[model samples]
Target: MDQVALLQISSALLLNVGFIWLVGSWFARRWLGSSGVKRNDVEPALRKLDLVAAGVSAVASVVALYAATAVMGGISLQEAGPMFWMMLSTTHYGHIGCLTILAMMILFAIRVRGGTSGASDTASLLTIVAFAITRASMGHAGENGILSVSLAAEVVHFFSIGLWTGAVIVSAYFVLTPQRVATLALAVTDRYLNVMSRGVMLAVILIIGTGLYNAWHRIGTVEQLTRSSYGLTLLVKIALVACAIGLGGYNKFFGLPAAGRSARGVAVVRRVLQIESVLLLGALAAAAILTSQQPPTAI
Candidate 1:
């Protein structure tokens, strides 16, 4: 891939990871606290991590905005400088890009002004949702207008991915650590796992539904799926997603039940979650590459 493609992938990966982290943190605190875990034990560390993720996401949004401009103008980064302002001021893509950046900035501000208060949490969630919507509005979906079914499907798809992948990432690397799991009461651990299992199942259902709509809308035929660059990348993405889902299924059906029984089970489940997350990340990379290609239907 070229520099622009690489930049797009980096920006997409960073933004998605950051968004997932924030969402996962939010869910972890809420679910764990509801399950009778002590919020004070985990809140401070999670808050700090959330802020860092927000900052990285904000930077990624800026990078994405510039990358979009450069791509639109068909110019190298340096040469694109002069046309940047023109693109920003005049194009629909630029308008949506600016809105996306604004949403991320707002989310960052909310995270920085940290409080465990319900109002603060609600603001953070709303801002992140707005960020997702604006980001979704910037690509093929945006071409159909804000009120279109395409845009709605894309938004739903984005959120489903966030819920599933983000939860796995946060659970594996942050929340379900050996130390933390050992500290939690058995009841609390079981409740948290149950809630997460249900949530992941719901997310997977939505992901499949929206994913099919998106693929059909973009590719339209089996021939395009095999012949076009965008279609082929999409097939790879679908395969990765299928693999991730398979792992998630194992965790939900078997690993989670085992986890509810013992601490060792939790460790095993966390390892599987980590593997699942890697697959999900690969899917995200494939998605980034898909965005850089022209969809077969667009031809």
Candidate 2:
């Protein structure tokens, strides 16, 4: 493949991997919430789900690392053997290693709490760290600056977005439900949702800021934005994000507040959740396209 084609293909794969990770995370959280286990019985279920999610995450990390090595670093697929193998093995093991440690923590927590593991919190923390580091290793934004602090900030920017997106999916799974959950579940979900909302708000702002900075650094002019492949792909990504944001706003302003008020309210929440999921998927698709585009080397 030519450089441009290779760049696009690799990025597309990485974006797909990201989408998979997001879905897996959301699904695991959902399963944990619906396990029908008591607080005392929740540890085992949470541990199992965490392990599953870790496996999914491992695959995603491998795809992301390979895409990074091939596209951003200019290594052909045929020449990517050592780099791909090393990065994949290292990152996968690292994720599994984190899961092992989290499992131990959950066991200890279970012994102390007598039923609950708090495994979900551990999974969240680990995923945030893993994604931030992996993104730093792979993205151009991270390759900027002499100190890699800019890279760290880019990772933070990516992580913040992931947390917001992941949290929304998680909240849709556990909170804003149509079914009758226990009072405790309701309270847990309520607190989580509140926290998630604030986090998402912050994440949106950061994404906008970082995105504008990156675009300015790369595109340099309005004409370049329209004329360049990278710029065009970015435009598509922004459009998708805008649509998703609109759906999110509807969920927040209309669906969430009215949740549980009546049968119609419950129905509305469910519909909006479904719509949000679709929009999120669309955004992911656009992200895949964006990843494949070559970085504008010159205006």
Candidate 3:
């Protein structure tokens, strides 16, 4: 694919990831919070958020599907369209299974907030496992061990993104809102900040480590980092990741301390989170470009 097309694909993938984060965070908060909202209240908000996420996901998925089809469709049509359908079938099921896990996580939050659940958390986890295996079947995991490692890294990265970002959003909302039914709000926020900070650190490490491994494996040489298409894409992604880390460092050292006392701290945290989100999106866009490029396999 051309650069423009590659960027488009990457942007779409980022959107997919972002939308999933949104669903797992903002949507979950609005629906599952212990804010005296009723079941009636819950359904409406959940439906609205789910609809938006679904729409965005569908668009991204269709574009990705079309692109994948464009490449594989011709070959499959000539050779074995049935096999193509079968692969798509498995992949589609995995997508659904992942989404279902997200939905269950939302419900889990609701139950944790003192609501009840007829669904099982174990089911959600199993679905995630199945989805992971299905995805592995498609990538380098199917062909080599390295792809599975990359996929595992991606899972950690994506889940951490969801947790840290979601916690940031939820804490900010709690702080800004006028409701004061619980004395534990501040305490909860503090504890959450600590947990999220730790999680974000782990995520940063995972992203960097796994990303480097994938790049080294694909590029295969020090010189290729600057000489190849994959290398250039890696450069852009690395820059974005560094910027994100800088913003995170600012939040951790300077901003988080003030986060408790002054409105300025809260504002700083919010702004930093937004910037981090943008950087994450940029990283994803670069990834999209990278996925479509020819790796320096022999070099």
Candidate 4:
């Protein structure tokens, strides 16, 4: 609950929220539009939300950079100010942080200029992907070198988390409003949920695969999992993720089919999604804490 930890959590949450909004918006427009609702009906609101998320994420990135510089140099914030330019110009972490900020700015610009074209959506998606990649690269993954398996596993793991948990966050809070649910045809709702379920299944698979690799690579032993702060936070994260996955499985197996049958069913699915999103956010907060700790393996 210190400043650095708070900033890390804020930055992680904001970055993922921005990524989710844009990606979810694209999915909704692309698939839901086939059900007779024009994309224009939702595009403006979604775009506005995307822009807001990007703006907050950009600001958080700047603040995080200052904090990281202070920590890296073992200096006070005021003292760190003098070293900030040097770090920004000289370090790999600083370079990735700059790229993350740049990507956020590009996303802001793309949304601000506002067109409903496929090209614009594609550009926005690419920018967000770049932002995710740079953010991942700035983590412990980067310590292993750009081409190492550690970095590759971490990048894949990060994307899987976003696709699974982040998607649910957007769906529960933004995309699946009661009004919007009522407007969407049963078939449309079913199709969207089916597609999402499939995507979530895929994400879960990748998450499990890469998560095991990351856990093994970082913690190294059963003793570490119980003994180290990093491992303990990671245990909490894994528990949260496991609960979220259980909820997701229920939705995929039961919720989607039920949703196809009635409006009430769709509402039930949304409620479950809301709960799942909360669990995922808790896991994300644990991850932020993990990042601030030294791994037992490193010790």
The per-prediction tally of clashing pairs is: 0, 2, 0, 0
Q: Candidate 3 lDDT, tens digit per residue, 1-299? A: 55335634754574446344553444334333443334453454444453444445445544454455445444432343345455456765334434533543543444334422334334433433443344334343234543466567655545555544444444444323334213334434444455566656776777677667666667888788888888889899889879888988998888777766655555667677777777866776776676566678643
lDDT (0 to 1) per candidate: 0.86, 0.55, 0.54, 0.81
Can you tell me which runs of candidate 2 are displaced by over 4 Å? 1-49, 64-127, 174-177, 180-195, 297-299
Across 104-154, the per-residue lDDT of candidate 2 in tens digits comes to 343334333432335745555554465455544454654454256656666
Comparison by lDDT, 3 against 4, better one? 4
C-alpha TM-score for every candidate: 0.97, 0.67, 0.68, 0.94
- What candidate 3 gets wrong by more than 4 Å, as runs, is 1-15, 18-47, 73-133, 145-188
For residue 125, give model 4's deviation from the true position in Å.
1.7
- On TM-score, the leading prediction is 1
Q: Give the TM-score of candidate 1.
A: 0.97
Q: Which scores better on lDDT, 1 or 4?
A: 1
Q: Who is ahead in lDDT, 1 or 3?
A: 1
Sequence-dependent TM-score of model 3: 0.68
Instruction: List RMSD in Å for every model shown.
Output: 1.1, 6.5, 6.3, 1.7
